[model samples]
Target: MSVDRSYIRVKAMLVSPNDDGSRHLVSRNAPTSENPLGFHRLIGGSVELGETHQEAIIREVHEELGARILDLTHLGMVESIFRYNGELGHEIVALYSGRLEPAPADEGGTLTESDGSVVPVVWRPFDDADITVPLYPAGARNWIRSSLT
Candidate 1:
């Protein structure tokens, strides 16, 4: 079994407006069949050898959420070690918090769920993040908390 010695990853904040000063988070579900790392909550993926972290995040946001990223700012890096179904990998995930362009309407781009099925974009109240269905990565919560402040 070959393993990737090193890899870079990115995650988008995907923020929307709320009546209050706080913002809502646009999240999705990871396709359980295709992705085991719970990657659905944020729009991101691995950065290729020649691709920059920002490029990858922007590309993924368009691909997954079907919305253009107006702004993407780095939220520092988090050391993530993931073990899925016996496969182990480590990532230097560059977390980012950004606002979506066009102010996500009721309908958004096609995003895959944990079962490898497509799910529509969802607007989640930041305060009620915990009760939402489908689990998210620890780094995502951390970034949101820090970014909002």
Candidate 2:
């Protein structure tokens, strides 16, 4: 059985600075994390019924990590046609670059799902966070490499 979901979403890739001023990205580890395991996801979800892209991003960050997102500078958008969890999925993703305000670090933030699973909010090293990983999207990867110079 192949499940199909076609929708639009907003992604907030938070650039958090280390004590030395180098930046790292915050992400969520996928439930099905495997192989290389333990990577943060692009922080966003479905745009919801009537929310604007910006609103959606903020809401997603808050819900997922309980952190208030700020300075959401729009990156770009992509038409992603891909397969997810053995299913076909398509998403129009609007990207944003920003930081978390009063954001938890040192492995502080976490999400408790309805099933009582704890999802860790990870601060992924910048170099390690690329398209080669399972979570980072190709579109954002290209934009990050080309535009964020």
TM-score of each: 0.64, 0.71
Angstrom error of the Cα, residue 124, model 2: value is 1.7
Q: Which ten-residue region of model 2 has the weakest summed lDDT?
A: 1-10
**Candidate 1 residues 13-116, lDDT tens each?**
34444345364545665455435433335456666677877787777667665667655677777666665445555666667767766555654645643345
* Candidate 2, lDDT over the whole model: 0.59
Q: lDDT of all predictions, in order shown?
A: 0.57, 0.59
Model 2 segments more than 4 A misplaced: 1-21, 31-39, 112-117, 129-132
- Predicted candidate 2 versus true structure: per-residue lDDT over 1-149, tens digit per residue: 22237544433343444444444455566544142554455666667677788887778777766777666688778666655555566677887767776666767767543344677666555555453445455456576555543
Point out where model 1 deviates above 4 Å. 1-23, 30-40, 85-89, 107-109, 112-117, 129-135
Alpha-carbon shift of residue 146 in model 2 (angstroms): 3.2
| Displacement of the residue 119 alpha carbon in candidate 1, Å | 3.2
